[model samples]
Target chain A: MELGPHILLALLESAVSTAVLALTAIGLALVFGIMRVVNVAHGEFFMLGAVLAWWITDQLTAFSPAVGFAVALVLSPLLVGAIAYASDRIVINRVDYDPERTIVATVGLLYIFQQISLMTFGPDARPVEPPFNTRLAIPWLEITEQGWAVYWPWGLSITSYKLAVIAISIVLLIGVWLVLSKTRYGLIMRATQQDKDIAQAFGIRIERVYGLVFAAGGALAAMGAVLIVPIQQAHYLMGGDPLLLSFIVVILGGLGSLSGTLVAAAIIGLSNGMIAVFFSPTLAKILATLLVALVLIWRPAGLFTRSSR
Target chain B: MLELSGIAAAYGRVKVLHDVSLSVCEGEVVCVLGRNGAGKTSTMKAIMGLLPLSAGQITVDGTRLDTLPVDHVAKHRVAYTPQGRRLFPELTVRENLEIGLMARGEDSRVLDWVLELFPRLEERMNQLAHTLSGGEQQMAAIGRALCINPRFLLLDEPTEGLQPSIVALIQEVVSTLSKSGVGVLLVEQRIDAVLSIADKVAFIENGYSREVVPAATLKTDRSLLEKYVGV
Candidate 1:
């Protein structure tokens, strides 16, 4: 059997999924790393973005696909960030730092937000239809209307939009990395994350830093939602899968380590995708679960660790 | 420039420092010597605005520091090198100093002065604070506080767990700060080490301080140590 085409297709799909997975997981890793609060409501922010993207696409009526995509990308994250900021100040901040209480509070927020999505947008999975459909030809490897070369050597084809999803994910991830490493604000955030009492002693306003961190997580989740909506239809409960997967990525990468989150995201995405292709989707999920269990049993700090100084 | 009068404080319902009155003149080293639970740490905390004063006044140049919060107290030209050094363990030595100077806002001169005081800090500036030895961390903690260019520095047990050489080095730093006209309230357990450098010394027994005396008088008289502080 010719392995060339099969391998190429697998690699491409894995690459795309890996990028998307990284974006989704980075937010979870950051919030957990800094505040040490597990934000169960984080997934709702992604669902909010998907629902908003679908709504925006429907409302735009006459806009081009490019315009709709652009609007969704810009608007969703900011909207979700605002919601997160409000929630942080109003509810999460008031809970203090009791670990058990925070978990319950955020999980409650997740369900409440999920219900809000249902109430506002209804229960059906709404498809966000792109404005135009155009296909690009890559010789024998035919690409989709969305610029993804999704063809095997057996004349099988897939959508190019999925490739676009991968590309956008890479861009966002790099942006987050640059912001965290290069900016002055990012430095303060990292310092605050390490030790809140010391950070305040150093003259950093901790409450403000927390708000910014929550917003960063919310924005990333929202961006992930927009990236996936064209491929995965928008639904009230769409955030469930991403939320579960993000936890796995965060644990596999190590708590509060940024680079670890990215690596774990890739491992999770590629392995899950490959396993699902060879076996059943349920089997792939079980494998991911087993992998997490093994990681927890062996190295509870995850694959990579930040020096928690 | 730092003064605390009739200051009363507590942790929850348990009172720690009671009716404490102390002052450090500009360019003078004032040391508070006490055995454990004598409220030496509580006095420093009150001056740094970490503990809420149940009753009393804390003024840095008559600015009423006690009413203000911790961050605002730094703005009033007061800095604290807390006991245990409390350095940001995750950050590098330089980053620790940098964050400590954030409220100084628009002034890089203080940063330069701190670096100058501890040149070893410059060598290991990129290393994490936790990775540093006790001596280096003590220097970093002091350096971090000094980066605020405070008029008054509160050092709580700076030599608590340090080696003799490091303790001597810190004594020298306190002396230098005095020469530079920064008032210092040095809290210490080793009365002899502090007496050597302090202009005035006060003994805290239980939660109240004894009468303040000249360090010269306290140094010559071992009887006073026996009366107020004992092994």
Candidate 2:
């Protein structure tokens, strides 16, 4: 493949990847933003999303792929959010703001969920086929109904579904920003994040707000999974990589800042894609981690923390 | 509008409030005076339902408050400003005030009144709470609480760690609230500030509440504060 065309393809792929990663990291950031709990098992929540999507597709085999995609996009996140809410209330709430206990509890949830995924899904990779993967093309690129490009300026291009996923990520990010900025709910969320005790003193039902926040975060992670499953293929262990990437996003963007998370995701995505084209994927990942570590050593609080609490 | 009777509270067997009793009628400013560990805050916490009372009862406007949760209590027209001007340090000043209005619901008009009272908040509405000076942040905290539009207000050490001007500003707000028919229960370390504004004064010490009397009588009896509140 010629380098120019290949480079364009890589950048396109990187842009889509960054969008997906940003969507995933935004969920993590939302949870951390309000609760200040790292939710170490957040990756497990991501895995659950993929598994749920796959299960829904299998159960609704008679439905159109678009219907399956739509259903999965909405339901997967809701399911994960419900589970996150229940788990937070039942388990995390009991710890009473003990950070060490929260870390341990979430880690336990991670392994427990991982084991469940293994048992239920049989430890094998499965492809999530949604009807959206039909076909469309742009001059040099071939796009499927699902949004994956089979052929592009370079060669075989990215998936249409992944590109759609990127589009959705941008929309969802904007939607969340509006909710946090313009709505009364957003005000309460910001207030609680700043000082939970003070929020309670002001008479806000902080517990309900927390449940909503956790659910929202879970839903976001699941939505990201729904978008990515077609491109990445669904598996029990699919969440770990995204989880790692999200952690990197948090560190690179500065923890709990949504704008920073999106920007960092873009940086990671572009660097990973372009560097992989020139060198090896593994080398690119190492460079990403190294860059993240260097940024942390310099800033510690991430790149754009604005004193939330 | 607010009443506490024989309230007893403890944290893991260490009782902080013992058989405390107090009441505040509408348009009244009642001050609870005590030293650092004199259970003054515990009284406010008990009223706000933050501390579970081991015994006795609490009521506001004749409705029992002991059974309600903290948020529900606020819904019943009770508002509280905790000690230390506990503003949400992360949020902008406007967002902090907005949360108070959100919690109270239907009384959002109070936000405008509070902004009128603390005009500094108007200029710095977009700034983060943490960025504000101690006095400005304290004003924001009080404004946030007042935005709830409570019939009964519970203020715990509202004037702590601030300049004299800010202290005067707070006292004026409390006095204005009282005159406007809002019942206020305050805890203050500064005896003169409390005496100046309080309609009635109750001395809390050694985990018990002594007889509450007119602020005028307590002002003349400085020896009483020396014996109980210890300055």
lDDT, each prediction: 0.83, 0.83
In candidate 2 the C-alpha lDDT for residue A228 amounts to 79
Per-residue lDDT of candidate 1, residues A173-195 (tens digit): 88888887777788798888876
Model 1 chain A: ten consecutive residues of lowest lDDT: A131-140
Local error of candidate 2 at residue A76 (angstroms): 2.1
Give the alpha carbon lDDT tens digit for every residue of B163-227 in model 1: 99999988988999999999899988888798889999878887887879899997678776787
**TM-score for each of the candidates:** 0.90, 0.87
Give one digit per residue, the lDDT tens place, for model 2 in B166-223: 9999999998999999999999888889889999998888779986889999767788
Top candidate on lDDT is 2
The deviation in Å at residue B75 for candidate 1 is 1.2
Model 2 deviation from the true structure expressed as Cα RMSD, one decimal place: 5.1
Top candidate, metric DockQ:
2
